[model samples]
Target: MTTNPQETTPNDWDTRSPDVQADQVAAYDAMRSKCPVAHDDYMGYSLLKNADIKYALEHPEIFSNKVSTRHIAVPNGMDAPEHTAFRAVNDKYFTPDRMQVFEPQIRQVVKSLVSKLPRNEVFDAMDGFAQLYAVRIQNVFMGWPASLEQPLIEWVEKNRRATLAGDREQMGKIALEFDGYIRALLDERRGADAAADITAELIQDVIDLPQDLGGPRTMTDEELISLIRNWTVGELSTVSACAGIILAFLAEHPQEQDRLRTSLAVGKTAEIAAAVEEVMRLQDPLVTNRRVTTQPVEIGGRSIPAGAKVTINWASANRDEDAFEDATTYNPHRSQENNLVYGQGLHVCPGAPLARLELRVLMEELLATTDLIEFGGANPTQNAVYPAAGYSKVLTRIS
Candidate 1:
């Protein structure tokens, strides 16, 4: 194995530093300008520029997604033929048709949650609304009962805390806790007559494998748990963060909020969706994704050898001035053709269609039901640290 000489260089930046954690996007932007390709022990190589991130994502053969050997992450943690097959199975659940059918339920879930918010009063949108909406909608989508809501919410918090602390042991225990929840659901579904729901369908789904490794086969309990866990991560973490970000953006930009509220009232789904995407692009909900090098490669004028861990800073890439003109400006009309919000290449987020639907429906209901959404109280918005994006506490008022 070739050792990367650059690894000996002192760290360019500390990702876990309180300064970076306080404002990840700003810190990354600074790094992108100074050192687009930075080496660090925590993230191996942090690619901050749009071009560098795009290059890494496009050339997944060199930058493998199998960052960890311990856990299986279904399609996300796989590459090539394996990723392709698993992704095929993963795509079936988030089809446009499935989203269309599921739209009303999502809206119903959002509406129910939105109605309960105390109008004209301050509330932590993250905990008070976004998290609740994310968990409830996920339960509805997965066919889980309402009883699992609180436990899942608590689990998400614990998982986030462990991740922030870089506590592998705690993360493993939390993963097992999550597996236990899904395992029970799977067992219950298997024993009873197959119900008409996503979870039930997943329980019966199978992936055909090449004859060399193994022929066609059903997904093992472990595989099912991993797949479900991936979905939950999307729903519980990214989606929830997106909720807080979107709400906070609207609160900060009342004019844009007014525009969306008007657009939504007239049933302008495309307009609302575009605006949501743009807002998310401005303040991305997802922070970073990991990739490990399979071969020596050069990126951003730096050489990295095989086995180097790479971190793709999505939040920074989406805001790269080289990629988008006036990158920070919120313009729904701006071309998103190169936006890395859902990512690119084989491993792009499969849950994007569902996430878009959820965000749009939630925003539409939020705008339609309330006259305004503005910052509440005198408390300043508190941004979530590394490993999480958006606000940790977004105090907002609706009237």
Candidate 2:
């Protein structure tokens, strides 16, 4: 879309304004009820309504995901036939059997960290807990050594800082720094037939390319690196955000916390996963995803032209009152059919199964280990600004 057309639309709302930056979810909610398809230079055309966002998600042919071509993003940055071939290979890594095999290692990671949260002392869950858990689990899945954990965590931070700064040159360097890490890992697994991790699988995995392209062949290093980038960013950023959100929610809501603990006592562990999803729906972790309209289309009574950029507001859409009754209220048992937490249709987060496993195990361990968790410390937690979602800090104390 960047190659074909540009965003010439006038601003309907200012996404960078103090009002929106202070609280993205609330601002988007207001936008959804008032002007569902607002536009800004930042996101171009923002889709705030559930129906409109779903329309874009389900109709990827019309609402293309290929928003840029300057850099590769594996299947996510590709469209249609090209995306389908790469996505097939991507989907295989997170199957039920794979998650099942990965659960014990995930539990080990969860336990090691959860044990470190000081009992009855104030701490930022995002600091010592959520962020570490995200990076550690990623290392576990990728078969990367623990020695890489601190470096990867630092890389994610630098990447986020670079993104928010709009420092492309620094972002490029940070990206290359990450690529070097993965390339070194790839080099190690190149001929290790005994390789049992997802990285090794990707090394040997073949993408069934269409006849017009090339026949089935192993993914190139560039392709593999891009895929890993997608997976790593999603895991580190959004998963940590989700963990912080869930922990913060439980700390603030004692009744809900006790109810979940009761559910766990009776072995209703699935409730932990349900609670994780429901909480994330309220304060969505993964924020906006971009698409480019392939043709002129009408959305939310607004006329959009071909080649205009579209931003799908997952946070707003999930909390939309029309989509779910009493939408803002937490309900773990509610239906998630329309939930765009992982997104919808094509380009949905491929690592969802692994993500769900990480989060569910994390909550299970925390709730099972702690007698109570509560909001504490006088320091006010800040809302993560636009382009970054979740709390910058979640102050809590465990007991």
Candidate 3:
């Protein structure tokens, strides 16, 4: 199809181009049709189809997770036995029992945020509700003070900007700023109490590292800070994006909204959770995850050399037409066993249970409290640029 330049030369695809940034999902959706794998300067090789992404996830060895040496990303940046040890430490926080115990707090946070929604007024849900929901729940989880709410929110926004601009210096400063916040918390918790909150609880948890590096030792402050940053910064931005996406979808599709509300009334939580997963599959909250090729590899009929960077395009993979029947339509009942919403394999999000619980509780609370959810009709929504997925500004209404 010489109709479009993108179809002719996939490598020329500029992720930072104006059209692509304006609506990433639409751009990626188009990319999947013309090219399954795309390459550009900023994002490296991008996997646009579900099969290719799953292939990479299934074989982490060939596509290594250790994409950078400049900074430590705790488990997200670790690979193999090292990743295993750190991952075990990460997994304990989101266990079934831990999530069960933490459910009420999630409900409380959601209910509190829901109660504050302005009725019959135009408000930006991204800033007013979604970000608040993510920040407050994160605070609840870590026993962080309410004072940190605004700062964390601000930090997330700044982090997004820095990341999109590819300003490594600014990102490094942002990282240190976050580490400072965690360091202060650690100081406050020192000898004050054990397992006071998840952050404090981490003090007692030990990573079963290799014997050469002092096996079974507690994580250092730096390591603890890195892990906590993964838990907080990663959660806040993406969850807020997810909340915005879900709320906007509800606003636009009254039938599905009513269906979910009724399902909530009947205690059809499994249905609601399935709906959330399906919606996320429609519009993924996280964009790309990076990996570096351990050796030269052939993927999707393209030859990629060793140590080359790879960006897994969750936005595209989740929306691939080949992956789901009528992939663009919203249908919760269809099989979603292959959904890459939270990811797959070893690095499959350790915090998924908590994320699911939070979203489920949020939906239950928002729907139960409001008779309807719809657009504010005063302002058009803004789609977030790359490095962030979902709405940047959503005009929402609740009646």
Candidate 4:
């Protein structure tokens, strides 16, 4: 319960400080030990400890996810009954039956990307495979065209830079640009016969709204666009980050990579998936999620007034020593019951099932295809800053 001097100050820690941006995991680790419930202007109260985060997640009533009044994030920004309805629509696309059918397509996407990589040559895995794999799979899943791939990748990069810069104007412009792309797709769908894909299904999906606002009705174009945007973010950025993180881990940890490769060879899909989860747990892809207090709350021995912004640092919480033994150590068999990799509670990522399936299939193909994976060239790996995780430039050699 050590109180930080900066806790009462305006900005406890600059979330975008050079040191933090350079290595967010280490910065968060330091914060967890020094001030688990730290306050700063950017992210009002950062809950670094596992306990505090778990409390925040379990009690969404106190810590609402409605952090933004400007933007609509589909179910992610909604609460309770409204969230439940929209979430039902969001969840419909990621069902087990859908994933079962989507598995081979995802595998083929991975295989096609991996096959193109030059053996024993130094290449940036993030650019060479991870980003492409993510974008390609997302397009295929959503029934988007191949032409959208490069533009989408460019959009993600610009959006990340704009967000990091805190350039609201640029961010808004970027959002509008993305909306243009999505709206075009939507327009195309509207004019033609209904396509057989998730995007088409979502376009036609209806939700039963409560009597207060409106009854059962179809979502407006704006709502549809917002929902797709949410899904796109999940698919492109988070998935890309996961791919890079998993591949980077495998490249560095040869023994574990070999073990995983062997496991995959023997058709041990579950084991492979567990290893992917563990690796990602050790180095999470998605960084933090925002929640604001609905009422005054006490967390990690710090009193937070009502309406205060709260940031749940998944990067820190997943590795909290209090919640996990040898938290930093990479142990695939460790129990993930308490792991918040995909998060916890009501706002937990609805795309978890799809993400897991994609990662598992990608890893399986990667391991089965390559004999050895190791650091490439002489370039140092460049870690992505806040709002993003994992290596931005992962130079690796696969043969």
| TM-score of candidate 4 against the unseen true structure | 0.96
Give one digit per residue, the lDDT tens place, for model 2 in 23-58. 888898888888899988878888988998888887
TM-score per candidate, chains pooled: 0.97, 0.96, 0.95, 0.96
**Per-residue lDDT over 213-254 for candidate 1, one digit per residue giving the tens place of the 0 to 100 score:** 586777999999998999997668998998888888878888
Q: Write the per-residue lDDT of candidate 3 for residues 52-131, one digit (tens) a residue.
A: 99999999999898887877889998898889999998998889998999999889888888898899877889877899
TM-score of candidate 3 against the unseen true structure: 0.95
Indicate the residue-level lDDT of 386 in model 3. 83
Lowest lDDT sum, 10 consecutive residues, model 4, at 2-11
Models, CA RMSD each:
1.5, 1.8, 4.3, 3.2
* Local distance difference test, candidate 1: 0.87
Q: Write the per-residue lDDT of candidate 4 for residues 1-399, one digit (tens) a residue.
A: 754333565666888889888899999999899999988878778999988888889998999988788887798998888888899888888899999999999888888898999897888888757888889999999999999999999999999999988999999999999999988888888865756777777778888778786877888888998899988976799999988888788888999887887777788888998998888888888888888888877789888877677888999998999988999998889899889988887888899999999998888888998899899866648989878899889888888
TM-score of 1: 0.97
Model 2 pairs in collision: 120-398
| Leading candidate by TM-score | 1
